[model samples]
Target: MAPKLDIETYPGNIINNEFVPTPNTRHSINPATGSPLFKVPVTRAEDLDAAVEAARKAFKSWSTTPFSERAKLLLEYTDAIEANRDELENLLTKEQGKPLSLSHTEMDFALSWLRAFATMKIEDEVLQEDEEKIIYSTHPPIGVCAGIVPWNWPILLGVGKLGPALITGNTFIMKPSPFTPYCDLKLGELAKGIFPPGVVQVLSGDDNLGPWITEHPGIDKVAFTGSIATGKLVAASCAKTLKRCVLELGGNDAAIVCGDVDIDKCLPKITTLSFLNSGQICMLTKRIYIHESIYDEFRNKMVEFTKNNIKTGAGTEEGVVVGPVQNKMQFDKVKDIYAQIEKQNWKTALAGQAEESRNGYFITPAIIDNPPEDSQVVAEEPFGPIVPLLKWTDEDDVIDRANALRTGLGASVWSKDLKRAERMARRLEAGSVWVNSHFDVDPRVPFGGHKESGIGMEWGIEGLKHYTNSRSLWVWKKIFE
Candidate 1:
């Protein structure tokens, strides 16, 4: 049975282990229905200040607690979330417009991150050790850390930042996207009983709130997941306080389908990922490069698969593969691309209607066949259920075209020939390169971006260090004697 989307119990911002409401409030819109799901507190300057101060006060104790102890509390918090998993999933689907199954997947993804963080610890590194002298380095928490989460995968990405920030001994404050703040605030509500006061806080606000959190003097670091333009603004705002930033920005990821690949085996994976979350994912395969030898056959098959297998509707509907675009801003952006498609008279293997007809923000997936490399549909990250399939003949030429984009978040090469795929994967400019796979991220592995895709890393040991400051210590043996 599906859970109810009642948010009456989880109200307003979470500060110092209590729900703090503001006079000014805003309602979260459901992309599936274009209706107000529930009212969310519009965090004011005072609320931001209080949340920051609370985190600062909690930091004194949280930073000193043993890693094992902190991990224990986080584990309990995970349990609390598990107990209410159904509610979180339902709320997420209503707000973010992903299918209910995907919502469950996001919850599982978030819990896995918390569990992984619980098992990992940051220990002092012995740089040099001898009878004469000993030298080592320690990772100390960087005070209060802020996580600015996006709407696409609110819980999973929020936990991606929260787990590292708290497990490493830093008190955390989360700012969920205004478009999808319900589940995040509810998560914070669940945390009230598990984490100590001020150890974990969540504030939901409008556009103004992001600048406040980024520019806040009390926040020592910020981990942001959003568009490249917004990420730039975040980094610039944090520059004033010289706060550490871990940005996972946009990706014009390219998926190269080789002639040798079993088209039937790989078609489902490509189409699913290309339009997953309505293509709102930062690491989604925005550009597809198919070998000319099999391009025609592959394109037709992909179009047929999309026509036969994919269905768009509200997430609650059974057997719906794609949901509405998460919000109006994105829906409008994709609509603009539709205009571009008409203006240029480009060929579309599968075309969705551009006109707004449905009561919701639903968009059928579109696939442009053999569009020019410089066209908007191919060049820019549409971030919708739209993609371009281009033809590639020469290996070197194809690799260069795939790497031409300024953003390099993720890329993949598909081919049965292991040596050939491996060789091509090495040349693609991306933080995560895969062969016969896309978006296969693991908690044990470090995930981040290269070039303008992002700065710094998240997950794994490297990501944990981003929330900490490194300190070196040297002790002479003679001094102790």
Candidate 2:
């Protein structure tokens, strides 16, 4: 059964395990119906100050806890989240409007991370002892850090940042996207009681509050996930104070269907990922380049698959493959792409339309046939369900064309011959490449971007180090008679 979308509203910032309403207030709407879901208090300058100060106060004690002890608490957190999985999933669907099942998957993925980063061998990895002078190294936590996350996969991404920050002993002040703050609040409500006061806090509001937090001198580091342009601003803001930044930004990921692959099976998967979260994802395959020998056949199959599979409607409805665009801005952006495509005389192989009598933010999936490689529609990243496909004559040409785009977060290669696919994957200029799958994230592996896609990497063993600073201690024994 689909879960009820009765969003529970919380007034303001959760600082030091207390909910105190601020001077400002805001409304959270359900994107599926464009109806007001909940009216909640917003963040203010005072709220931001309280959050930073709370984290600052907590850091004095949290930073000294044993890594093993911290690991135990993370495992407890995982258990608690798993026990209330259904409730958590409901909160995600209420404000965010993603399919409930997918929401659960996100939560399940988070549990694995809680344990992975928790049980990590930090003592072995960071602490080294030498008999000569009792030389050792310690991984100290960065002081009060702020984690600013985007709307897409809200809970999961927040957990991704949370797991590492806590395991490495950093107290945090988290701010979720205003578009979907319900789940973020739920996390705060639950965690405030479970963890120590001021150890982890949440602030929900508009973009203004976030900028204020980023520029706050009290914050030692800023970890964000959003657009490349906004990421640039975050990086710049942190630079002035010499504060650390971890930004996971935008990507115009490319998908290549080589000459030797089966067109019938792979085309469906390609169409599925192109509009994931309504193509709001940074790792989505926005650009598609096909081998010319099989280009015509692939395009036809892609059109058929897209038309049949990608259905858009209320996220809580049954049998819906994709949900409504998260809000009005998303809807307008998608419509703008449609209007632009029509004006350019570009061919739309499979076109989807918004339904009448529905007050929802929605759009059908689109499959655009051969467009000029240099055209903005093909070259620029259109973060909508619409995708433009291009054709190249040879394998090398396809590689070159795919790598031409500036953003390089993720790329995909589809082929039956493993060797060819592997070679092609290596040639694509991105942080991650998938041979058969489009977007699959593993906690044990490192995930990040290259070039304009963003900086540094997260996940894996090295990811834990991002929240910590290493200190080397050395002492020489004096030779005395």
Candidate 3:
């Protein structure tokens, strides 16, 4: 049985291990039903100040706490989250519009990440050691760290930033996206019992909260995951304070299918990569290039698979593989793109009318067949269920086209020939390139974007170092002697 939601009892801004609710509140709605799920308490400017001050004050002790002790606390927190996993998944499905199974998957990912960060280590590196001199490098935690999490994968991304920040000894304040705030706010409430006052906090608010966090003097660093346009603003805001920043921004990932690929074995994997989370993931395969030799067959079979296998409905419904768009703004953007595709009369293997969907912001998944390179479907990231399938005759030309985009977060080359796939994957200008797989990211691997996609890395030793400042120690033994 699923738990019931009660709006009045829902949580508010978490500051110093307390629920600090203001009179002003925003309705957190269910994307599938377009109904209010909860009245999320909005954090005011003063609340922001309090949260920052709390983090700053807590930093003094947290930064000095033993790394092993911090790790223990993180593990304890993960256990607490696991205890409430079912309720969290239900809330996530209601608020984020992903299927219940995907919500569970997100929670699983979040838990694994927290555990991974807990066990990870950053040790001092000895640059040189000799009779005359010894030199070494160290990483020390920055002060107050703020994480700006997007709506798409709030819990996982929040943990991605929060885990590293806390384990490295920095106090943290998370700003959850206004569109989907319930589960994250609930996590904040859960933390009160586990962490010390001010050690972990979450502030829920409207658009103004982002500016407050980025521009605040007390925040020593900002780790943001969102769109390219907003990422630029975050970078600019942090520039004034010279605050350390780790940004994971937008992606226009491309997946190339070689002629020799195993069609029967790979179709489901490709479909999941292209349409999972309603295609809202930053690293999802937004553009697909199939070798011309198998283009027609692949396109027809993919369309048939999508039409027959995939189901779209409310996330809570059984067997729902795709759900409504999370909010109105994104739904509008997707509908506008579909309108353009219709106006251009682009050949589509499967095109559904988004406007015709019942009450909620559901856009039927559409697959355009061999759209022109400059076409909207191919060039822009619809960030919806819409996917573009284009034919590729020349490997070099296709690779060039894939690299032409300003965003390069992830890409993949699929072929039975491992050497051939690796060769093509190497040429794609993405931060993470894969052969025969897409979106197979591990917490131990470094993941980030190149060029306009993002500014820094996340999810590995490199990402852990992003939370700390580097220091060098040098000693002259001869002088001491």
Task: Give per-residue CA lDDT, model 1, range 284-333, as digits (tens).
Answer: 88889999999999999999999988887889999787899888888999
The whole-model C-alpha lDDT of candidate 2 against the native structure comes to 0.80
In model 1, residue pairs whose N, Cα or C atoms come closer than 3 Å (at least 3 residues apart or on different chains), thus clashing, are none
What's each prediction's clash count?
0, 0, 0
Q: lDDT of model 1 at residue 52? A: 89
Residue 330 deviation, candidate 2, in Å? 2.1
Q: Candidate 3 has what TM-score?
A: 0.97
Local distance difference test scores for all models: 0.90, 0.80, 0.89
Residues 119-173 of candidate 2 have per-residue lDDT tens digits of: 7655533244454445667667888888898887888888888888888889988
Query: Candidates' TM-scores?
Result: 0.98, 0.94, 0.97
> Candidate 3 on 1-481: residue-level lDDT in tens?
2223332466578899998888899877888878877788788889989998888899999999999999999998888888888888988898999999999999999999999999988999999998898998999999999999999999899888899999999999999999988888878877877888999999988999999889998899999999999999999999999998888999989999999988988988898778888889999989999999999888898888888877888898898888889999999999999898879989889986687356688887899999999998888888899999999999999999999999999999999999999999999999999998999877788999998999889888998899999999897888855
**lDDT comparing candidate 1 with the true structure:** 0.90
Could you report the Cα RMSD, in angstroms, for every candidate shown?
1.9, 3.0, 2.0
Which 10-residue window of candidate 1 scores lowest in summed lDDT? 1-10
